[model samples]
Target: MDHKRDKEAVLHLYNKILPPLAEKIYQNLTEVTPLFDDFHLEKVVDTWTKDRNTTSEKEISLENGNVQQMGLRLRLNGFQAAGAQTFDLSKDLVFLLEYSTYTVGPDKNTRWLEKPYLESWTSKEMEETASRWCEEIIDEITQKLQTL
Candidate 1:
């Protein structure tokens, strides 16, 4: 696998997901409802890793069929700000959380290799799964980010 292309995939995910997640978190912060409280918190994406797995059967035919590549995994870590200890009402007041997830999709080169028998089905299923998971993760993280 080309390292440069792999690196680009990682960066692509970071650029695609982080901004919306951060924006929702920021809006949640400003609302300051009963669910929201003032606290010092910082969020950062630790890093991403290359995914070698390809979901496309076409790509699989070219190489090993059983492998699933995790193109990039984004680990979001955060810590509660200082002088905000009062927010620690719960003993488990976790100031830090790391949400790590990966993205997988067929690139242009791999598109032609997809097995005609299962291309659309596999693609749709994977896409739906990714969408649901990402939504759940973003919702959970946004809630936590606001609380912190």
Candidate 2:
């Protein structure tokens, strides 16, 4: 199997999965569509989420040409939602979501976000994509809380 092709396919799959998952949350929950204005949802919420976390350089090799690998980690804390009386988000309801996407293939060349890379996937892009998905899930939960 071609490693580069595999990596690209993974990223593309994520790009496809995230938006629909978010939309599903919204459509099913119904109450969330009003949290942000259409403009706010499209621009601010989406764009801000894009900035929530970033890829960090894990390591680099000098002896051979290896660009290293990295990923993003994020935690949303102290989120409160309104139920019938206002849902209180706490550590238990804390929803711990961890995201990671890695390059899978033979040789060091099969690394995501590696410079002079063989794979077409970038860790940064993958991180952002994962975050977007998480945000959508959170938004769905938030709406559920509001109506409860």
Best-fitting candidate, scored by lDDT: 1
lDDT (10s digit) by residue, model 2, range 41-138: 11001111221243534232222212222222222333333434433221111111113323322122433222222334344554544445445556
Candidate 2 backbone collisions, by pair? 81-87, 82-86, 82-87, 83-86, 83-87, 83-148, 84-148
Q: Score residue 55 of candidate 2 by CA lDDT.
A: 56
Candidate 2 matches the true fold with a TM-score of 0.26
Task: Give the range of the ten consecutive residues with the poorest summed lDDT in model 1.
Answer: 89-98
Instruction: State the RMSD for candidate 2.
Output: 12.6
- Global lDDT of model 2: 0.32
Expressed as tens digits, the lDDT of each residue in 17-123 for candidate 1 is 33443344344334332332433323233223223353333322112222223222323333344543233221111111112323323221332122211112344
Q: State the C-alpha lDDT per candidate.
A: 0.33, 0.32
